[model samples]
Target: MTEDFINYYRENISKKSQIIKGVNDFLVWGKSQKINFAICTNKMESLAKNFLKKLILLSFLIILQVLIPLNIENQIQDI
Candidate 1:
């Protein structure tokens, strides 16, 4: 499933997906209203950036965050 998703993202996302209606306008409006905006994704950092780049929205975006999980044991250190 992961491979299929990755393959589809690479092969089709840039070529096929359409932005939802009013999306850019919404973002702009949000900014005008002093509302912060962000793009959050579970995908790898590179993939997320590439997606924004493909959408031609990278330059307009303020920030995007990708949440990657780390091993629980690595999350903290006990002395």
Candidate 2:
């Protein structure tokens, strides 16, 4: 299910995803303040990284070095 969603999102990311206005400046400011960004989402790590790469922001992510695991269900299920 997650893979399906991520594949679909990746196909549409070009149209659906975009770098927010002032994001570059904000990131620079954050860097100046010694702050790092951690992107937290249910989205796949690869998809998130690809999107950032498309926006030329992947380098910043390397500095942050926080790629949370891609798939770890948090719900309690019947065993």
Candidate 3:
């Protein structure tokens, strides 16, 4: 059931996703300032990464975190 929802969202809803205003510019500025960013989402990691990639903001992140096998502590340590 969860997989089905994820697949449906990926195909039907994700295509309509939009980047918020000034987000790209902010990311560019943040990168230049040496501020690493991380994304924490309930969404699947792959899906979240794909979403960020589509917005051209993936490169600005130091890590992407989802509730997976790895705990949040481990995820943060990886940064």
Candidate 4:
């Protein structure tokens, strides 16, 4: 279930996640070019923000988009 995966992500996956090679350079290049970057994810807003923050990439993004249905949002909120 969603809750199980979320729990697992929090406990095991988040800390181990790695930034892709060149992402920082790419973001830097994009910034120099006056391009804006955003993260569009199925993850909850807080989770997505935390993940990005953990990777030190949160500052590169101007927007964080969490695309989840109302029911899933409610379920995540409840948990």
lDDT of 4: 0.81
Angstrom error of the Cα, residue 52, model 1: value is 1.0
Regarding lDDT, does 1 or 3 come out ahead?
Answer: 3
* Clashing residue pairs in candidate 2 (N, C-alpha, C atoms within 3 angstroms): none
Compared with the true structure, the alpha-carbon lDDT of candidate 2 equals 0.63
Error of 2 at 7 (Å): 4.1
Where is the poorest 10-residue window by lDDT in model 4?
7-16
**What TM-score would candidate 3 get against the native?**
0.71
Worst 10-residue lDDT window for candidate 2 reads 70-79
- Candidate 2's error at 2, in angstroms? 8.4
Off by over 4 Å in 2: 1-8, 62-79
> What would the per-residue lDDT of candidate 4 be over residues 1-79, giving only the tens digit for each residue?
8889887776564665787899889999998898889889987777787778888889888888889999888767934
Q: Encode model 1's per-residue lDDT on 33-54: one tens digit a residue.
A: 8877678876666667777888
Overlapping backbone residue pairs in candidate 1 total 0
Model 4 segments beyond 4 Å from truth?
Answer: 1-8
Clashes of each: 0, 0, 0, 0
**RMSD in Å for all candidates:** 6.9, 6.1, 6.2, 2.3
Best model number under lDDT: 4
lDDT of 3 by residue, 1-79 (tens): 6556667766664577788899889889999999999988876666777778776878999988776555643443322
User: Model 3, residue 18: displacement in angstroms?
Assistant: 1.3
Error of 1 at 19 (Å): 0.6
lDDT of 2 by residue, 1-79 (tens): 7556656778777676677899998888887887866766544456666677887787665333333443443421111
Q: By TM-score, is 1 or 2 better?
A: 1
Which runs in model 1 stand beyond 4 Å of their true positions?
1-11, 71-79
